[model samples]
Target: MFQKGDYTLEIKFQGDMTKKIVGVYRASYFDKLANETRYVVSTKFQPTDARRAFPCFDEPGFKSTFSLRVVRPRNLTCISNMPIHSEELNTPEPGYTTVFFEKSVPMVTYLAPQYVVVSSTHKYHIPLAKQAPNVEYAASIAPKMVEFYEDYFQVKYPLPKLDIIGIPEFISGAMEH
Candidate 1:
């Protein structure tokens, strides 16, 4: 039996990073600059895939805010639902960097992604070096699209930033988060 009161719960668990293109997975692409295959870690949590990454309510109606931190190789970058708040380099471990992201607004589990990527440079959108030129058209056009939508819908975008990434091994044509 229980009374009406406040409660807190904590759970710790780990999940495997898979080679498939769903959930938390690794993908590889040829690097023309380095002449080798490089791998990146990314996520696709739409339509109920978030449970595979971590323990969660895993339902559309179970909305909650999240603050995320990730440790990755010094050569890569991490992106989450919110902008980065701080980054610690080579402290917890050598050759590894820890990134902390800001707390997210209340959102469904599917929108809270833990996306990490590998790139040669921290340029716009972090596309592979070879594909950088191709991003120019999209970069120029995106603001117009956003402006059109904002004008048509008369509602501002809820997030501070919108990151559009290109996944070479993605299974779906597009995903909002």
Candidate 2:
């Protein structure tokens, strides 16, 4: 599967059967300075769109949090929204390891994302619980994103907590709720 976005976003199954996507998820966005602009991301991908991004079931009604797992050769790196639950070396490889991400929160179809390299972003990939939290991405580009949002929105941080992730690929632009 593609490892471009922030969260691990994985799921584990007990049975041995192949799952397939039934439909596609779509979204859009646009600038408002013109006063009538409409923009959207993750647009028309047909019935099996998610597969274009990654190999997985692309149905929406199948709403459930996934236990996303990503494996990378030690030479490379992985970035996700949650902290690593465990790390195990896929034996007999010098530059390979299995990085397991903690389970994600309840998610719906329109609420998920496919990783990519389409634009520039400043995402803070925070790890661990709250209360004077210690950010895992200390040297990340989040500081800039915070500044931009804090000023434009003219509001304190919207959420009690935030976890931002910046990937390097996408056919469309950035996305948000």
Best by the lDDT measure = 1
Query: Quick one: best TM-score, which candidate?
Result: 1
Task: For candidate 2, write residues 78-116 as lDDT tens digits.
Answer: 544445678778634666677777766655433343221
Query: Mind giving the per-residue lDDT tens digits that candidate 1 earns over 1-177?
Result: 878998766778897788987678889988665678878788878778888888898899999788787888887777775899999999589988888888888888888845766664465444356666678777788889888999999988777887766776888765666
Q: For each predicted model, how many residue pairs clash, with residues at least 3 apart or on different chains?
A: 0, 21
After superposition, candidate 2 runs with Cα above 4 Å error? 1-48, 52-62, 109-169
